[model samples]
Target: MKVYISGLYSGTSPQPGIGLSRSLRIAYPDATLVGVEYSNRSSGIHWLGFDELWLQRPWEELDLPAYGQLITELLDGGALWISGTDLEALWLASVFPDGHANLLSPPAVGLSRITKPGVEAHKGLPLQIPPFVSTDHSDWDLHAFCRKHDWRVWLKGPYYEAVRTKSWDQFEAVRSALAKVWSTQRLFLQAHVSGYEESVMLAAYKGELLGCVSMRKRELTEDGKTWAGDVTEVPEAFAASLREIIRDINWSGGAELEMIKDPEGQRWLLEWNPRFPAWVHGATIAGCNLPAMLVEAATGIPAEKTTAQSEEFTRVVLEVPVRARYPLPPLPEPYAG
Candidate 1:
């Protein structure tokens, strides 16, 4: 079987494509692997031995007709595709209202409910949603809110970006900077929850929870992305709640629920990513291959639920020898007088 994976970049802030590609390779060594990316700067394009590489137009450059045509060409041979980034998956869902069999991604209808401003309204999840105020509300008392949280709060953009601010001045500065950078005023503030970080990674298909793995962050990059983690067992109650969530949304594909567990053991839902987390390959090494299970579920063969064996994973920088495989571009001819 052939597989197409997107988001193949790796760095301080890595993407999930390379991890998924590696996990899929471990499971199906002979299967054709195709790496899909939007930029030549994606480092994984050359390091990983993918059977094929496809570069496409950036997200903003493609319209519905163009995207539909791209999908048609990619899945022409009944190949399965798993989006490795949340934005691309959300965009695909928007463009293809009916969804595609060969594409594995969360349904668009339920995405908003699990994302930022909308997640606050999502009911039935066994977690606390931190109180937040949107910038659109000019009447909000910023000082009072900061004082309530003991001068600690997280400033967040509508889609992706967060900064922790402890004082009124810091809050305003961060708010202004994020607004300018993201080019929007739709920012929000959530009181910081003092706790340890953890994430639940799971795969679902047509409302059925196929498999899940819970892990706690042990090391993080400067940007707070997971750099090392250890797999932890899911409590039965927590597992049941996860099942209910999948069934409630009729979610299909992989997802990661990021949360913070406080000293009182209360879990606060921080974010719900529509696609797999970047550390998914760690789960593969720990004996739970979620990428493989996702592919299997998409193709009608449901794999058994998998739990990770007791294991830990960490990332380290490495250098690989680079060689030019394709012919180099011709040198410009000398200018004639």
Candidate 2:
């Protein structure tokens, strides 16, 4: 089976993408893997043993019609496209002509909920979320919101993007920052969740959960920006809940769900990502090679769950790379065709 990985960029030193690719190759030595870099500069790292590498200008600069045609050709040639970047995954879900099955529907309704107030006043139904008020600007009356919720509330975006603040003052700070961001881009805010954060990453075939691995969050950024944690074997109940959620969504391909353990130690659904996590390499170390399983899913083969090698597990620690930020090129007009 041929697997095509998109959004491979050069200049990412200590190379996260290459490290992921190398791990995948180690798991499935005979499989064909191709790297598609969006930049002209080559890594020069001999991919060890891989099928091919294609470097081109960023996809945003390409003509949509031609790019779609090219992608269709590649898919026709039996390549399953897996995205390593969030924007790329969103773009693929939005722009792909085939409307290939995605794990979660784009956050249209979720975004709407964040903007409109009093929407989430009603409790969420079993699996459906209640509507809530939202603002593009965070300058709303925090005192009023806190008073209404008895000083306990969550701040999140329409589609479940969230940040927790212990006090109204801190919440206001987050709101101000979000307001500035929303002025330039779409944003949402939701109530803070008080619970343990757990994530389940799975390989699925047309909504059927084939294999999954779950982990609990150990450390998180103050604003919940990045996840840093150790891997624990998923509890049976949590794994079942995740499988049920995926089945309900009728997801296809790769998907991940983040759940929170409430004060009562009950898990509540948090947010859903229909693609691999940034720290998914941790799973590869645990013996669940996601990239390869994705390859298998793409090729119509069922992937068997492999036992996680607890002894071989490695903890991933991320440090900000020192680099000068260059001015990015002018933004292209939104894709209109």
Candidate 3:
């Protein structure tokens, strides 16, 4: 089987994509991985074992037709695209529909709900998001949210890139940077909710829960990505609440809810990941293998429940020398069911 994966760029690293490929290999040993890098400059293009590495069109150039043609080529090659980024996931959820149903990911509705404005509008609900405003209507109106929250606001791009801006000047700088990256998309101003970060990863189908695992971030880098973390228990109360939100949204695939625990011990939903998180390898090793589960669902194959591993995983940086190899056949998987 051929599986196409994207996320070649995940904030100064490509571990996210490589991690997915590694997980996929663990789940299905015989599967061939088709890595999609938006740029040839992506360093992970060197990480070994890709059956094929295709440089995809830049995100800014992906219109319906361009994206559709790309999909056709992939499907014709018998490759299933596993989204690496929310942008790609949204496009797949919107375009392919049943073709990629095994991903069991959120539909367009669920995807839309995770956006900055969507999170802002749903504040005070089960997730209790912090106050936020988009610059859609007016910049002046967004500043009001800053005054109301009186916190350092995060100037965020539509998909990625978030910069903490306490004053107007810094906001402008990040805004200008985002414009160059994600043109034609709106920028959002989010109230900085003070708290330590935690995340819950889940795999569900048709509004019913399969299983889930949660974690607390112990160490983080400047970009808010978890560097070191330990697996924690999933709170029963929080599980019940997250289930309701999933049912309400009719979510159909893997998702990660990033949260922040405030001084009062209340957790606010900082972000909703419609697809698997970058640290998903941690989840897979923990026994809640979302990639394997997703592949099972997508392929319509029945599989028994698997056990989880309890522990922590630290993100480590390393390098490998590329070696020359002749043309290779499809990758191998042990349980490519």
By TM-score, the best candidate is: 1
In terms of TM-score, which candidate is stronger, 1 or 2? 1
Summed backbone clashes in each candidate are 0, 22, 11
lDDT of candidate 1 over 1-337, digit per residue (tens): 8888888878888888888887887767778888888866567777556888877767667575877687877666698888888778877788665567777887776586676844832466678888887877663576777788897789887656788988778888998899886778888888888889999999887778888989999998999999999986677887887788788777877888889999998889888888888999898879889888878877765444445554899988766544255333468999999
Residue 168's lDDT in candidate 2: 75
Could you tell me the lDDT of residue 287 within candidate 2?
73
Best-to-worst ranking by lDDT: 1, 3, 2
TM-score of each: 0.87, 0.65, 0.81
TM-score for candidate 2, residues paired by index? 0.65
lDDT of 3 by residue, 1-337 (tens): 7777777664543336777777777777777787877765566666675778877666676576776776867666555666777767777776755434434456776666677645632443456767677767576776677777774788887655678888777777778888877774488888888888989888777666666789888888876788878876687876777677777766776777788889998878767777778787877666667776766666665444545666787778777554244232346777856
Off by over 4 Å in 1: 118-122, 166-184, 301-310, 323-337
For residue 140, give model 1's deviation from the true position in Å: 5.6
Give the per-residue lDDT digits (tens) of candidate 2, residues 1-337.
6666654443422223554565567656666777766764444223433467765566668776676677668776666666655445555555552345322222222222223223331133232332233554444554555566565666654332456656778767776776564443344444545767777776665556667777677766555533455665666765677567545555455556666767776555556555666556667767777656655655656544445655233334433322222223457899887
For model 3, state the Cα shift of residue 64 in Å. Answer: 5.3
- The lDDT for every candidate, in the order shown, is 0.79, 0.54, 0.70
